[model samples]
Target chain A: MEINGKKYKAVVIGGSAGSFSVVSKILSKMSPDFPLPVIVCMHRLKHVRSGLVEGLNLKSKIKVVEPCDKDKIEGNKVYLAPSNYHLFIEFDNTFSLSTESVHNHSRPAIDYTFSSAAYTYRDKVLGIILTGANKDGANGLKDIHDKNGTTIVQDPASCDIDTMTKAALNLFEPDYILTPEKIAEYLNQLAS
Target chain B: MARFISKTVPTLSSFERGLGLGLKDVRELSAFMSDVLGIPYDHMPVSFFKRRLTNVFAKNNIRNVEHFKELLTSGDIKENIYHDFSVSITEMFRDPGFWRYLRSLLQNLSPGKTFTVWFPDASSGEEVFSFLILIAELNMLDRIKVICQHPSSRITEDIRKGILRNKNAEVNANNYIRIEGNGNFKDYYSLQDNIFVLNTYLLQNVETVTGHFLNTAINEPAGLIMFRNKMIYYDKEVSEKGIKTLTGKLSPGGLIAIGGKEKMPESTMSSFKCINEKERVFKKHGFDISWNNGN
Candidate 1:
């Protein structure tokens, strides 16, 4: 598989339910000096803010930190959307957090981040839909694909809960379908 | 090897018909809102403007964009539309780190010197109450004065009466615990008929006024001025003008706090020094004569 020699500006990953471990595995294998900024949007308990970032940071070579509203985007860092805030990628490539009512029964809805990134970055974005129990990210991944951005989905068979990946597959054919290990390897190749 | 698929992806249009309005209809509605309602809908983000218009349409049972425009121009629905235009999402100690930073800044002030803090857009009294709680906790309530201004007279009246929304009690308590590290959250407010009424004693040094921050002139300088989150709603020009006006209200060596998500306009950046960049805290530069004179 090849990326068609296209350099991407940013990578957005969306997940829920069983995605944390997969995300940890992928981050653990990433180079500390990865060039593109990575944004992770996942479902979590709104009232709890401490554990997710810490857990991901423990194994990841690159710095993984929860970003505050208006934090500037920088290379080589992984930003986890804070719990209970809908994170949007601004036109200036910075983040804006909104406390507006929840969508898809989630505050930090996957669709909000994916759509905002697609709108701002357009074809420069690489969107990945990982394991989850719902169809929240399906339309967003489709939006990325429609905007000429690269789209990847974890193979349904490999996902602990295949509902999310299947939803994406049902909506539109993605550019790549791979297991978690292969996805990490593909990302590392891009870094190289 | 990761499986790569080569499929002819049919182009999908992600654009949804906004409120079922044609471009001409949207333009007409925008004009009505600006000319008749004085909202300047053209400056609002398209998505937000559409959402609000759709909400008003649904709530008022207007048939279409034309009807909506007709109702807006009639002057009878102006108040209803205006009521829905305001965004009021206030939280107690919205950002704990910001409050902590403010605490540190306040600590450096000269002991026993009285200072005034201004909240130009005190929406629902959550932030004003939070500051009062912080001052009370610091045992400096007598040394600090608060002036809260809002556009709505009803909200100002409620704020003056020390009434807060009961729904925020849990989050308020959690934030208080995080800030103070220990406390019975109920100590700050008494519950009456499911609403939390702040203790009137905490309101001793606070005054509530009813007026738009932009129209109201501050005759005296404020040690600290907070106009957070409200800037995001304003258009670029309005926000720039607001920053200038707020900067003019700051005392020499005073500080301005904005929403963490907001950025200081580039034109005004030279006038203030960024103290805590991430927290969006800026300080106006000037010599403090009292400190310089060793008071």
Candidate 2:
């Protein structure tokens, strides 16, 4: 699946439950010089804050770090939403973290990141919804699609837990629906 | 190219207006709050006020701003509205790295001199309790003095007694482990009828005051002032005023820590030097250099 020569500024990936390994696989296969900022918004245990980023860093070619509040968004890096904070992509292309009440029973809610990125980046965004047990990313993926941004959902049959992908498919028609391996191939092709 | 977005989104204003809440309506409401509750709601960020008002309206089942205004003018729901507006969400040892940096800074302070710290917004006492635990762990409880201030007397009283809601236990315990490396967090508190009560012994150096830091006159200077995450609720002008008030209370060379997301207004930058820019830690200038460097 080619992007048809459209230049994208940012890529936002939202997942939950079984998405960690899928995200790790994508990141490990991504080239070191990949030129777009990748934002990962995953539902993580609020109590266990230390291990996810470190675990991702060990296998990923690109740098992965949990963003502090107001950290500038930059290319060739993977920014993970920190636990217990709802991460919003501000118009300035920097992150603003909020400790406001949780949404969809999750802080670091995928909807917040995806909607904000869609609003801020508009048609320049590429949003990908991966494996998860809940419907957290459905509205967000729809928002991206509504804003003329490219939206992708991992095929429900390919996901370990298909609830999230099925939810997205039920909500709106995404630009692409493929397995994790195909998703990585598309991302690599986009980079080139 | 990054451009500044207006702090108050247009959609919120139109939505409020559709509900019969125009600028004049908000102004009148702000005036009523100031006169009745002593809170300067006029100075709050419009977006923040709108969000809170939406919650207030939904919770109270108020039909519109006009109905809410009538209820406010009646004077029966002042306390309820105040309580709803003042409910702060905070966690213990928020940003573990900031706490670790604070620990090192406290250790570097001049030995044998009493250290003074202030919590201008001690909402629910998580931060105050977290600091007390740190001081106790360092065995410097005797050498430290803490003053906690909140707008509600009830909250102040609860904090003075070291009472905290149990909902934050898991996050607090996780942060404590990150800070301490290894230990049972239960050693510091006892469960009393489902609430976590800090050991009163650790409260020796802490005092709670019922007042608004923005309006209260504080004569004492503090070595460290914690006013984190509260500024985001205020408009630019009020945020500037609050920053000035807090900075005025700092002793020379003392440090002030703000929320990581907050930025020091350019107007106030000359008075304090950045210590940890990412953590929003700043130290007031004009103290003898040797005092910090240890000559």
Candidate 3:
């Protein structure tokens, strides 16, 4: 969407156990010129520091970093939430860090980011739930669908850890359910 | 206005620089004096405060105005500064006729199906709860949705978290029940000791959303948009833009409301058909209007 002479597209991704490989597979297929701010949240122990930033950086073509409070969302940036806090998008399209507890036992919860982005961005939002071990991103993907935004989930059979993806696919009819390569291809097409 | 001739003169820039005062401090002081005295500090500057400063400098035998900078840096003069600068502008329900007309308008609109009203500038939460009271009194609370601006999300983190403290809950609820009708507005909050935290269910039902009107349009077209007494600080250009945005966001048959003293400027006034000129309500023309950027 064009807002105030600037174009915007928001992609939000959430995953668990097999997120690193899925992220790498997707990013490897994306073209160099792909534009859009992508926010990713991966469920890990609240106390244990996540290697998500480092892990994803090795796999992605785009710049990846952990987002700080009020950091403006910019095209081509990949922002990951910290392990313990629920990340939300402020009305201004900037990331806000909240310790407002958890949903479904995940601190950097997928639902929080997905719901907040969907609410803030409206129809321009895209939500993706990938390989995980729990039903964390199911309600979130559904929330995105409810808001007239796009929702995507990795194919359950193709997912290494199928519980999260299987749960999401069964509960909500996501707009697209595909393998990692296909999901990557679709992302590249949109980003281009 | 007579220009002051200092006994021991210094150039304006030198005087300011010597005093170690930044432009922001001076601007704040100007605003404070203007607000307290109900005068335009820039156009019709206050001479008395300037003269007082001059006298203070002269009495101290300070060669340059900079020498008295200790006052601002230290405590003695800060208290005096605040004492003279505080503003007490608004009175309770300052405009009686507006309230009366609004009450009557609510009674008239009572027969409609789901008459939603939006108050976009609810600074102290009074207007949102006030509308809630009116709608609840009409037994139409279930039918109506009052979309209020979420105050916390816009500003800093501390300000966001610290807003709407528990102390005002009792009074706010009492005002709602007493003014409109008796129903426990208190039930909408959880009181632990003196801390009354608002129940999310009440907030959710009332439908408050965090949004920036400058950057985003209202999610759903509103039946009525009321932004009153909030834009007085804005100049004509800004005011016209606000009016245009509100008009564009209103539903086809919906109404637009503003403060009694506020007006749609001539440049963009044609977009609206005045419903009640004195009451500051207008009907949207429902024509294609440009979202032309407003500075």
TM-score for the A-chain in each candidate structure: 0.97, 0.97, 0.91
Candidate 1 docking: what grade?
Answer: acceptable
Candidate 2 Cα deviation (angstroms), residue A154 = 1.8
Tens digits of per-residue lDDT for model 3, A4-70: 3334478899999888788877877777567788888888764334476787788678988887544
* Number of the top-ranking candidate, with DockQ as the measure: 1
Candidate 3: list runs displaced more than 4 Å.
A1-8, B1-295
lDDT winner among the candidates? 2
DockQ of each: 0.25, 0.09, 0.01
Instruction: Estimate, for each residue in B136-158, the C-alpha lDDT of model 2 and write its tens digit.
Output: 87788998899998877768888
Best-matching candidate per TM-score: 1
User: Which segments of candidate 1 are over 4 A away from where they belong?
Assistant: A1-11, A17-21, A24-39, A43-85, A90-96, A102-107, A118-126, A132-139, A142-151, A160-177, A184-192, B1-63, B77-82, B181-183, B234-237, B287-295
Give the CA lDDT, 0 to 100, for residue B116 in model 1: 83
The digit string of per-residue lDDT tens for model 1 on B74-166 reads 776776575455555546887777787777767666788788899887777788888888888778899888998876666777788888763
